[model samples]
Structures are given as C-alpha cells and as structure tokens.
Target: MEEFSVRHRRFVANYFAGKVKELRFQLAIVVAGCDKSLSTFTSGGEVSRDNHQAVLYGFSAFTNVIQTLKDAVKTVTNEQLDWSKIERLRHGSFMRNVRNAATHDGNPVISGWADGRYFVPSKIVRIDGFGKTIEIPAPAEDVRAICLDFAEDFCLLLRETLIAAGGIEHLKGSKFSIEEVEDAFANSTFIPPFAKELFAQNREKIEADLKDLKHDPIADAVKELGEVIQYCDSVKGD
Candidate 1:
C-alpha cells in the first residue's frame, strides 16, 4: 500500500463495493445435503464436503474488493497494508468461515431482504456427511443481508485503495477481498470525508471509479465520509 491522497483513497474503496453487491445478488440459493450436489458422497453413502470452497467463495468478493482498499491505506499510511492478519478484523472471521461452510453444504446462495439492506452468504450445510453434525452458524436473514451490505463497504475500501495506488496497474490485476480492503483502509491516516471530495487531484480517480458503478456501494457519496487510514507500521512506529 502506497501513500494516497484523500480523493484517491475514497475512489477505490467505493468501486469494489458495487461489484460485491451485484455479485451477491447474482448467486443462486439452493439447499444442502441433497443428492447429486457438487460435493461428492462417500462409497458407504457417507459424504464429506470440503468446506474450503465455501471459505473461498465467501471471501472471493472480499479479496477482490480489497485489491484496491490497500490503496486507501497507502494513501494515508505511506506504507504497505498488512495482509498478514486481514481475516482478524471484526465480523470478518465468523462470516467468512460461515459462508464457506454454507457453500460447501449445498446452500448454494444465501440472501436477505429485510432492513432495506441485503447480503448473501455462500450457503453450505452438513447433512448425511460421514462425520458428526457440523455446527455451522444458523443462517439468519439479517446477518445475510448485512453481509451483503458489508460487502459493498468493502467495495468502497477497494476503490479507495486502487485509486490511491494509481489504479489496477499497481495491483498487477491481482484479486483482493473486502476484509483486506477495509483492514487496509482502517490503517490509513487520511480518511476522505464521506461523499465529499477530499482530494482535488483524485477527481479523475473518482470519475473512473464512478464509471464502473456496478455495485453502488455508497448509497450517497456526499453523505459518505472518508476515514484517517493508518498502517500497522505507522502505528507501531508511533
């Protein structure tokens, strides 16, 4: 993560957010433990599913979303965003692990419509598996929805990062995640005023981010405020 101007930080963060929402809406919801599902069953009618897929699926959006979020941190921190512990951020652990399970167990798609905010988790459940019942978190409609909304936030984090880092060219087209994005953004020293153009030079980045507004992460840009993102090294050195 390189140091970023205010405007560039916000630009990338918001961009990936939109993509996350659109992708969440597209995932298909299906029940798990059903026969003929993607996960294969065992010869003795006992099947074991690789929950890793669910983990990967859940974070797929987030990881991609974060590619740019690093920029948000760099813009403020003037250093690299720490990817070592990205999964440690609040609400990220349970959700990422949980959604992976859902996807693995055949809960193809999980979504929420309540509270005018929706998020989907990759649904996975263990039924008829060879081992004991896996205690995956019970799917709550609200959690699902918030997950989607949070995904959008990640998009914002991504856009800010990318723009701060001088766009996808710096990322080398690598995919990032929401968790990574927000974590990096959280580490910055210059949080853009939500919905306010914090950096005049970043206007072009903002426009580029806007051009690909497929996720619509910021319901209202003017109202959205940027944060003072700082890096781990910055703080540790402080």
Candidate 2:
C-alpha cells in the first residue's frame, strides 16, 4: 500500500480548512434563518410556511456541515468520526433526530405557549429514530443556541483532531504567486481555454484582485469560533 505523503496530508488539511470556512458561512445562514422564523412568529403569532421552510433549510445545512466535517476528518486522519464523542452530542443525537423529523418526516409541529405577557413558539419535532421524541423550545432561539454550542465544540474538536493528524501548516499558506494561481486557473477544466485567454488578457486586473484578496484561514476559524461562543453565552444568559 502506498503511504500517504506529506503533500497528500497537506492537501487533506487544505480540504479541511475549506470545509471549515464553508461551515462558518452555513452557520451564518442558520442564524439568519432562525432569526427570520422568530421574527415572523412574533409578528404573525405563527411562523408561516415560507419562514418555517427557512428554519428547515438551516437545519438541513447544519446536518450537511456535520457530514462534511466527518468526511474531512476521515479523509485526513483515516479515522472514522465518533459523533458520540462530540460533547454536544454525548447526551443525545438531538441535532440529527430533529433534522430527520423536521425535513424527512412531515412538517414539524410548531406550537406556542404563553410566557407571562409574551407568547413563545415551541417547535415540537417527533421521530421514532433514536428511540425518543425531541421537543425544541422557542426554536428560533433554542435551535440557534443548540447549533451555536455544537459549532463551537465541534470546531474545537476539529482543531484538536487536525493538529494531532498533523499541524495545519498549509492553512497558513494562503498566499500564492500570481503565476501559480494563473497556472491553476488555466489548467482547471471548469475554466474554458477561451476564459483562460480572457484571464490572461486581464492579467493586471486578476493580479490586483488576488492582491486585494486577504484571507487567513486560522484567523477566520478563530473569529467564527469566538462568535459561536459569544452567541451561545448570550443565549444561556437569556
């Protein structure tokens, strides 16, 4: 069997980094969706189908994030991800169960209750899977809180796992020579030869764009993790 080379390991690290970036974007979507759902419920006294669909979309996106992280870890470390080992999921597979019930099963039963002068919407998700039924409270806030906590913990877990696999050295190597980037774009099948020619014709613009593009993967991950922690803490305080 061929041994996985350092280059291969670096590639895996890069892939993991890319997925982490995607997770940040998806998490933002999840938060926005939850906020929209809550706002709709607050104004209309119930979440409309369109607003509920946004919530479902957010949940589905989260599930995809989990699967992608698992794939990244497995590909990089040659080890299967133990979801139970994740701190958030240790108590139960709440995320997966809720996602399955909400998206795969029929519409999630959205019920509300009176809290003093305020009416709070509770998302009740029932599924036979995991041998239990899960009720998410004030899903707009509750579900978002759950996802935030999970995301923070999961990001930490991924950092540790990737570090153990090998330091994410390549993640820090974001800057590439213009020639190298151009060569990649030129060779990419997605970019037609004509496009490559156009790219060449606009090399100055491309170089300027590349120069203006400042990205630090590790910094970005840390910033997102911090935001997740802040949001989780705020929810807990609430």
Candidate 3:
C-alpha cells in the first residue's frame, strides 16, 4: 500500500470540509419544508416534496463524508477502518441506514404531520454486525437533531483520525488554509489540449476571470453549520 502524503490528506480533508457546508445547506431546506411558518404560503404536497428532497440530499452527503473520512484514515493506517469501532455509531447510526435506503430504493417516507409534528418512516430496520437490531425513530425533527449532533461529532472525529494517520505532524507544520485551497481549486481550469487553439484568443480573459474569483470554504462551512445548529436547538421537544 502507498503511504499517505500531506497533500493527499489535505485534499481529502478539504473536500469533506466543503461537503459539510453543502450538507448543512440541504438540511436547512429540510427544516424550511417542515416549518409551520410556511404553512400559510405552501401547500402540503409542496412542503412534503421539499422535505423529502432535502433529507435525501442531506443524508446522502452525510454518508459521503463518513465514507470519505474512513477511506482517508485507512490510507494512513495499516489496519482496515471499522465502522463498528466508532464510538458515535455504537448507539444507533441512522446516517448509514438513511443513505442506503435513499441510494438503493427511494427516499424514506417523510409524511405524517399532526399537531404540528412530522412523522417519518423507516422501511428497513438496521441490524449490526453483532446481531443487535437498531431502530431509528421516525420523527422528522428528531432525525434532524441527530444529524446535527452526528455532523459535529464526525468533524471532531475526522480531525483526530487524521492526526492519528501520520498527518498530525504535517498538520502542525502546515500553512495551508481552507480558503486558500478552495481558491486554488476555483481558479484551476481544465481546458482540453485539443480545444487550446480554438479558445486561444480568450485564454487571457479566462485566466484573469479565474484569478478574480474568491472562495472561502471554511467561512461558508461555519455559517451553514451555525444555521443548522440554531434551527435544531430552536425546535421545542415534541
């Protein structure tokens, strides 16, 4: 197996950092879909559709973050990464269950609204490797709260895992910032060699425009996470 390099670790970590922001954005849409405030303007069908779509996209992004973290950590460790060993998932992991259901069949049912409460349905029950069955609750709000907690915990876990994966020293000495990395990626253009001559006249303008674009991945991630946390905390228990 090839040894992990600082650049590879950085790339994976930055990719996930950006994904966290996107996951938060999707969750925001899910929250809006369930908000009673929207009842005045939006029809039940529209709200339901929006909620379902948000959950599908959010859960899918969460799963990707988990898998990407595990894969990156495995690159640094000689032993294979084990989901069962993770402390966060020991109780019950809806992230994986939700992701599988959404990817394989269809989105989990986000219906059932009464007394200003939303009830979601999980078609398949999850069984762990140890023969223990884990049941995820169907309340849409509860699921969203759990997802927030999961995202926060996973971010910390990723930092720790990466440190353990021989990147700790590299990180300590690293000068790279998330904003700088994102900016570099934004400015990178992949023009095909065959098209180089066709667009040669506008190459200077393209390069100039790319350089003028600014990206702040960390700021965006933090803002989105804040929105999700505030929304999760504001909802009174049902």
Candidate 4:
C-alpha cells in the first residue's frame, strides 16, 4: 500500500506537470489570437475567417483545460471537484454549449450586431444547433478570461483539498516540490516559443495594449499558497 501511494504521487506529479505545459501553450495561442481578433473587431473591420477558426480552437482548448483541472483534483485527492462551487465555472455552461455548437453544429461565424439600447455595433460569435442558438462575445476574450479565473480558483481549492487529505508531505517522492509548484504558478506569462520573435518585435505596442487587460490569476493562486506555507512553517518552528 505504501509503495502504491508513492507510485501514484509520482505519476500524478509528472502528469500534472505535462498537462500544465500543454495548457499554457494552448493559452498562449488563445491570447495571441484574441488580441488580433479583438483589435480587428474594435477597429470596425470584419474578423477574418482564420481568426474565427482560431477562436473556436481556443474554445475547445479552454473546455479541455477545465476538464483536465477537474480530473487532476480528483486524481490527487480521490474526491470529485464540485464544478458548481467554482465561481467562474458555475456560469460556464454557455462556454460548453458554445464548444458543442461549434463542434457538432455548423461553424460559428463572427457577426456584428448593435446593442439593443446603445445601437453601437459589437461583435459576437453565433451558432445555431442542438435545438438552441448560442452566442458568445466576439474574439472569445471573455472565454479566455474566465478560464484564467477558473484555473486560479481550482488551484487554490486543490491546495486546500491536498492539505486536508494529509498535506504536501504525502507528495514527497514526487518530482513536484512546493517551491517548484510555487514558481510555476508565479510565472503567469503564457507566450509560446514560436511567437517569441513576433512578440519581441511588437513588445512595446503589445504591452501597451494589454496594460488594461492584464489578468494574473496564477499569480494570485501562488500568493495565497505562499501565505499558507509561511504560516505552516511558522507553526512548525514554534
């Protein structure tokens, strides 16, 4: 039984590390695509078909990340994660519906429509299928934003669950250490390797554009965990 526990923790640590890397790559794609698509939409230009496809791809990626996090928590703690308790995910049905509509129904296209009262044109990705019509904000930036929030909340929940289930000591033999995990969570930038050159070339403008749109859920998660770890260490020292 002890041997099994050791092997299980090792497997989980390695699996989670790999999954995080993949999810970060997916997030990079989503962020870059959204930036371009949103710029086009905001400038009153029609979003290109390629950009529309990218947004759909991002939706699929975001859905995958949510499922992966839920599975990871269950695997680590042997308890199901209650998605409804997750604030960002509680209202995420629309995103799942959008993914289903995009995959099963016809492709959702970016369309511009005026707000009811304001009459200012805004973009939306709309699709009709599965006995319903689903519309999500254009460029799918909201989807990306919600996914970031969900990931952070899920991490904090998993941390608490792990501590309750016997604490991080149980993961001793695993490749994941508390410090390493904290570092990963602290580095929230999600730029992919292929985009490095492009990002470097436009760093100034991109940074300026994203200044108001910065989201740092991962950093928030790390900060909370750091506080808990500090308290635990202090208690042990006393």
Candidate 5:
C-alpha cells in the first residue's frame, strides 16, 4: 500500500495546513475587530477601549490555542512518547489569567491624558493583603507578545507531535529509514499505484518468507522445486 500511504500522507498534510490557515485567519479577525471597536473612543476614552480589546483578544486567542493543542494531542499513534512533557495543557487556567491581568481588570489601563499612539497597559495591576490595588504602568506590548508567543508554540508542538508518531522503527536494526520500505514499493515489477499498496498489504507475509529464505536457503529452494514439479505434473495430466 505504498501508493495508499503516499496519498494518505498528502491528504493529511493538506488537511492540517488548511486548518492552520483557518485558525490564523480567525485570530487575525479577532484582533482586527477589537482594534476597530477601540478606534471610536476619543483620547482618554481610547485608553480603556484599547485595553479592553487587547485583553479580550489575548484571552480568546490563548483559549483557542489551548483547545487546538488538546485536539492535536489526540491524533498521534505512538504510545511510548510522553505527550505531557511537550503538551501545553499543563498551563491551566493560569495562562488565561495572565492574559486577563495583562489585558483587563483595570490593571492594563492607566489613568492619564490620551496619547495618539495605541497602547497596551501592562503594569498597574497588583493587589496586596491590605486589599489595595496598584498600577505598574507597564507596556501593553509585553502582554500581547506573550500571548502571541504561546500561540506560535502551540502551532509548532502540534505539528512536531504528529510527525513523530509516524516513525518507522521497524527498520531500526537494518540501518534503514522508511526509505527501504518505500523502495519496496518502487520496484517496477510491482506495478504502479497498486504496486506499493499491494506490498504494504502483504508485507508481513513477504517479510516472513524473506526471513525463512535467508536462514534456510536449501529448504526454501527445495520447496520451490517441489512446487514446480507439482505444477508440471498437474499440467501434463490435464
């Protein structure tokens, strides 16, 4: 089933790439919509407006990434790999909170005269035991960048995971990659499209026969000769 495997891989790649494109577009739309909504605010009003959308988009994007990572983890076939070590699921609700504080809850907005440039309020969000709120005046860029970083990492880990699962460890001792398995399909005697697929379907049987022949050549040849004789005798009698 070399032909089938090749076609299947192509389909998977195309399928995932389409998904990536769609999600990225959705994220962009979220950002754009937030920016558009904030644009209507005048001067000081824009401060709260920008902060609100920044927090809104950041939290939504982080949540979307978390969900996507969870879905990608389910697609892998390898049981030996520790998905936990690489998966982002461990990040928990804390990640969303980080975005929230950096984006919302009055921490991200600073009370001041309006500046023309769009700003992200990063500092000015700390609560003490005495129940006092403080504003740090930190830059908004930091929060936006952090959320974006998480999103990018999610995309990378998901792709790497599925690729790792397709490992052809059966070829390990032979110093062969799946390349040899591919070569088996490439043999012209096997025929096109159907050839590789046929071999893939019968690989276990073919491998067993090969193993027998390698270890017991005399017996294998004798068996072949006997089969030839039986075939000739049957044809003659008929």
Candidate 6:
C-alpha cells in the first residue's frame, strides 16, 4: 500500500466522484428506455439495442469505480481502509465476481439483445468454458435500484476515506448530482434531445484538464533538450 498526501487523496476521490456522476447520467439514459422493459420483461415490448448496451456499460462501470476506489483507499495505512472487507459487505461479493467476469472474460462483448430479442429474467446468463451455463442475476429494474444504492453508499464511503486520509474538503467540486440526474431522467420517457450534453461536458472538462497539465517547466525543458539533441545529430550526419 502506498501512502498518499491529502492533495493526492483528494484528487483520486474527486476523480471517482466525477466517474460516479457520469455513470449515473448514462444509467438514466438507459433506464429511460428500459423502464418498461425492466418492470415488465415478460411482456412484449421492444427495448432498443442502445438501451441494452447502456445497462451493460453502466453496470460494468459501477463495479469498476467501486473496486478502484476501495483498492486505492485500502493502501492508506494511516486510514486503515480494507479492500477485501468492503467487498464482503452489502452484495459486495456478488459485485466483485460480476465485475471480474465482465472485465476479464474471453468474450469481450456481452449483449442485452440477441437475435432481435431483449434479455429478460433480470439476469445475464452464459455458458462457461467447461460447458456450464453461468447465470448472473441482473434484472433491468433491479439494475437501476442497485446502481442508485451503490452510488449513495460509495459517496459516503469515499467521504469517510478521504477525511481519514486528511482530506477535509475533497470531492466538493463534483458536479454529478445523483438525485438531480435521476429526477431529470425520470421526468422524461425518451432519451432527451440534449442527452448529448454530458458528452460535450466531458469533452470540455478534458480540455480544461489538459490545460492544467501543460504548465510543467521540467517537461518543457526536457522537450527543448530533445529538440536540440535531434538538431545536433542531424548536423553531425551532414
């Protein structure tokens, strides 16, 4: 476990906070489309391919964000955070196994729709290498509830972890509000015309982060030295 300064801890906490917001936003888009499909999977209704993709992608991200945050905090000896213990509580074991399978499986692409039919029964079932079919329960309706629950729990855990690590004010700048995003998604039945706003926001944030990263004097000096070395080598060859 590596020790991190308050600054670094805050950075990591804020990073995960943003990720959670992004995940919730995306999940809302999917849930909007799958709302009916989830509550009434047995009923005949057409759930879009994109909607199914959203659920899978969102679920995978939710798992990964939790895992990364817990792992990083576990290394903080001053805080006594334990990764393994976290995974053992509150459906944590189930989440870990699912995340591992989704991340490391040989079949990289898992589908919510097959042969123009949407998956129901609230689970993703597949055959393993030994010819055994593995069923992971993930009902679409349950997915939404689970994600919201996890998000709340994650935020609380992260706040505590950061404070323990001496970050008194970390994660305060996160703009992804779970309740607001949920309400926004809930009020709409379809993917809003402006649902693409999140993508644009992400792009702008990336640009801002790049700008902040460009002020390294040592890196600039190294680049200049490399250019000079290349010029000298070219002249010598001449």
The best candidate in terms of TM-score: 2
Output the lDDT of residue 10, model 4: 45
The full ranking of all candidates by TM-score, starting with the best, is: 2, 3, 4, 6, 5, 1
TM-score of candidate 3 to 2 decimals: 0.53
Q: Which ten residues in a row have the lowest lDDT in candidate 3?
A: 166-175
- For model 2, the stretches where C-alpha displacement exceeds 4 angstroms are 1-5, 43-46, 77-80, 87-92, 96-142, 163-223, 234-238
**Superior by TM-score: candidate 1 or candidate 5:** 5
Instruction: Compose the digit string of candidate 1's lDDT tens values, residues 27-63.
Output: 2111121221223432333233333234335444433
**Taking the tens digit of each residue's C-alpha lDDT, what string does model 2 give over 1-238?**
2345645544554555566767767766656666666565667666556655555565566666777677667655666667667635521355545545555565443233232111226555465656677664443435566677677677767666655654444445435657877889877999878888888899998788766765555454455545555655565443
| Candidates' RMSD to native | 17.8, 6.7, 7.8, 16.1, 22.5, 20.8
For candidate 3, lDDT tens digit of each residue in 50-141? Answer: 55555555556556555655675565343356666554442235565555555554654444454433545444565555767756555344
Total clashing pairs in model 4: 0
The reply for model 1, stretches above 4 Å from the true place, is 1-91, 103-105, 108-136, 139-144, 166-238
TM-scores, all models, native as reference: 0.29, 0.56, 0.53, 0.49, 0.35, 0.48
Superposition-based RMSD of candidate 1 using all C-alpha atoms, in angstroms? 17.8
> Would you list the C-alpha lDDT of every candidate in the order shown?
0.39, 0.59, 0.51, 0.50, 0.43, 0.49
Clashes of each: 61, 0, 0, 0, 10, 2
Candidate 4 residue pairs in clash (backbone atoms < 3 Å): none
- Summed over model 2, clashes come to 0
TM-score of 6: 0.48
lDDT per residue, candidate 5, 1-238, as tens digits?
1123433333333344445554555444444444444464533343455555554554555455445434433432222334354344333233434434544443433222223333344444566446777544444343333334444555555545554554422211222224456575686664688777877888777665544432322222223333433432343221
User: 4-55, model 4: which lDDT tens digit per residue?
Assistant: 3554644564465456555555655655566676667677787667766665
Candidate 5: worst-modelled 10 consecutive residues by lDDT: 168-177
